[model samples]
Target: MYLPSFTLDEKLAVITGATKGIGRAIGRAIALAFAVAGADVVLISRTESDLSKVKSEVESFGSKAYTICSDIKDYAYIINELDRLIGARPIHIWVNNAGINIRSEALNVTEAEWSEIIDVNMKCSFFLAQAAAKRMKESGTGKIINVSSVGGHVALRTGVVYAMTKSAIIQMTKNLALEWGKYGINVNAIGPWYFPTALTEELLKDDQYVQEILYRTSLKRIGKLEELAGTAVFLASDASNYITGQTLFVDGGMTIYGF
Candidate 1:
């Protein structure tokens, strides 16, 4: 029997928003996962202190860890910084996990709020992928994982713009896969449901919201952060070589089950 190769040995992965929440979880989990398989990682975030802490955690797994303290909002700066850190080395995986959401109703949303969400969640993600893809294209192989949300597929009460950005992300993944498949670049997305993180803390705290979420989900409970790690590892490794332009919804059947 031929078991699939899930090892990312000798690979280098770059994760944005690596300081906190899902990004932090993915950063640490993937770093350690890859390390256990013999890979190095580069953690990127706006906070130097947090980056250092994560770096220590990654290094604890006996893998080399590098940190980049910069704002993902600044497209040019991030691209330049990545180039500086990576030099001639090819990035085997790039996870675009940096995003923000404002919980305003559609009528209450402002121009500033709209732009900020678009800038950080959409614009920044695209440019970063472009930069990573350029390097990956040259190397003739790579993996790009975009962190989308269940809101992308089904509308949520969170905010209109946030849902819109995530929906765009799903489409973006497909488009990128179509364009870059020839270069051996696999572009895909992961849409998660209610997971306990800094971003969803307040929402998860509301009993009413929690009940609603559970009712819709087949698992009838929120997801654990660790539950997402395996999916990320699968996509980043050689096991998902034939999978591209796909959105793997890690939600607990929230997307498939309709009310």
Candidate 2:
């Protein structure tokens, strides 16, 4: 009930890559948190079916929900639709959590694989941050939270390219925050260690990988989706009013541990 002053109440938030995994969990947290604080939500992803599911979940709390099934890689389409979506009101919050990671060793990585990871993770992150900042500047207030990973801050056990892309996200979060902070937009990122979602279900179940993730983790375990969701909400809300240009690691001390 403290949202207008201490929370994100009455804010309209848009979340990308909300169909599954980290993105999906972040979207759910954003929607439910905002609903509890009194706000509306709009969910976006590539699948209409998944968007429908999110909408249903958001509506469960009696909050207004909107959905758009579009690919973030198609920036033009996103721009056009964003205009329609924010017709008369400014978008108060934007969470860019949509990304993909294709793992390969350095020598074996394909040209196409490199391009896809870079385009989706780096290119898309920059442009979307740019677009959202432009609109936020007009309103003179907004927040943009990027869902990064421990991969960005550390080398991944399986994918170097994915790690590189995430590293770029950390810098992107910093640089964008530098440029947009004066415009009244707070730019920040969440770097998670090991969290189970649709993306990591198979890998998380593997004994070898599970042991590896746990061994390096100070908590001696992988993270729960709900655990990271709180950090997302804090970044999106007024509680973090003075925080910006930083990556909050929800990594269970994984980042601090010496390999």
> Could you say which candidate leads in TM-score?
1
lDDT (10s digit) by residue, model 1, range 1-259: 8878998888999988887755666556656666676678888888889989888877887888888888888768877776787789999999998888898999999999999999988999999999989999999999999999998999887589999999999999999999999999999999998787778788788999899889999999888877777788899999999999999999999999964
Scored by CA lDDT, what does every candidate get? 0.87, 0.82
The digit string of per-residue lDDT tens for model 2 on 1-259 reads 6544545667888788887655666656656666666667878788888788878877787778887778889977887787787686788888888888776888889999999988988898888888888889999999999878888877776778888988888998999889888999999999988777767778887999889878999999888767787787888888888999999999999989984
Compared with the true structure, model 2 gives a TM-score of: 0.93
lDDT of 2 at 221: 85
Model 1: residues with Cα > 4 Å off, grouped in runs:
none
TM-score attained by model 1: 0.96
In Å, residue 207's CA in model 1 sits off its true spot by 2.5
Minimal lDDT window, size 10, model 1: 21-30
